[model samples]
Target: MSFDTPDDRKYLESHEWATTDEPIRIGISDFAQDELGDVVFVELPDEGDTISHDEPFGVVESIKAVSDLYAPVSGEIVAVNDALHDQPELVNEDPYGDGWLLEIDPSDESEFEELMDADEYEAQIA
Candidate 1:
């Protein structure tokens, strides 16, 4: 199945994606949500919590399994998608939009350069 890997975001090898803009938004990629099947719950870090790059900041539980949601870069959590608490399927229905997990106030802009672009990420998943 084709995944929605938007050109505007950078991705992790493990299938999370993050916006490059300020207060960068972070979420699991379309590919990841599809693979996980229907999401049942999301456990996210509290606002103001600091998360390190490549570290687990939350968990996504699906019918298939529970997976750790990793931070794409070092940042403080500015916001989280509370909508997921009642409607986790948004992760499958609109991962890049309504399903977004966190907004980060990045600690290092340079860290974005270390992430994979859409093409690189597609190739890595291919």
Candidate 2:
């Protein structure tokens, strides 16, 4: 099945989003959470931590395996979804909403170009 990439956000091949807003939200894509089965835990970076593009920002543990959550853009983490610490299943129930992982203040807006658009990312996964 093809996934939908909302026009408002930029997507990463790793299945994260970088919004063009003050605080960028990061979350696993619906396709990703579906493939992951039940999300058991999400180990994410703390606020104020700097993360590099295409690098592992944290870990997402599922019943199937532990996957690294990659940064789609370089930035300093501004916030994290505290709810996931106690209720990791949120990632499965709402991969694009309440399941969001973190928010970052991007270091550079141009770095977003390195990420794929909806169609390109869809082709890569296909």
Candidate 3:
């Protein structure tokens, strides 16, 4: 099956995607939500909380399984998508858009260079 892997972001091997823009946006890839089935809950760190790269920062629970959300870059969380509290299916409906999980002020922009590009990520998942 095919998955949406946008060229605008970098992806973790575990399926998280991170944008390079300021206040970097983070979210699971469409492949992740598809694999997870219907998302039922998302547990996220509050705004202002600091997260370390490659560390677990939150959790996403779906009908099929529960998964830990890892940090793609170390930084203070500037925003959290509270809409997911009541509309968890947004993760499935729009994993790259309204389904976004967090935004952070990156401590090291270099970390983005270490992540897989869309082509590499698509190859890995293939």
Question: Which candidate number maximizes lDDT?
Answer: 3
Give per-residue CA lDDT, model 2, range 24-125, as digits (tens).
888888789888999998999899999998999999999999999999888999899999999999999988789999999988888888887777767777
List the candidates ranked by lDDT, beginning with the highest. 3, 1, 2
Candidate 3 similarity to native, TM-score: 0.98
RMSD of each predicted structure: 0.7, 1.3, 0.5
| Model 1 agreement with the true structure over 58-118: per-residue lDDT tens digits | 9999999999998899989899899999999999999999999999999988888889999
- State the displacement of the C-alpha of residue 70, model 1, in Å, after optimal TM-score superposition: 0.7
TM-score winner, 2 or 3: 3
Q: List the residue pairs that clash in candidate 3.
A: none
| Clashing pairs for predicted structure model 2, backbone only | none
Compared with the true structure, all predictions reach lDDT values of 0.93, 0.85, 0.95
Could you say which candidate leads in TM-score?
A: 3
Predicted structure 1: clash tally: 0
Candidate 1 least-lDDT 10 residues? 1-10
Candidate 1 vs candidate 3: the lDDT winner is 3
Off by over 4 Å in 3: none
For model 2, the stretches where C-alpha displacement exceeds 4 angstroms are none
Put down candidate 3 lDDT per residue, 1-126, tens digits, no spaces. Answer: 999999999999989999988889999999999999999999999999999999999999999999999998899999999999999999999999999999999999889888999999999999
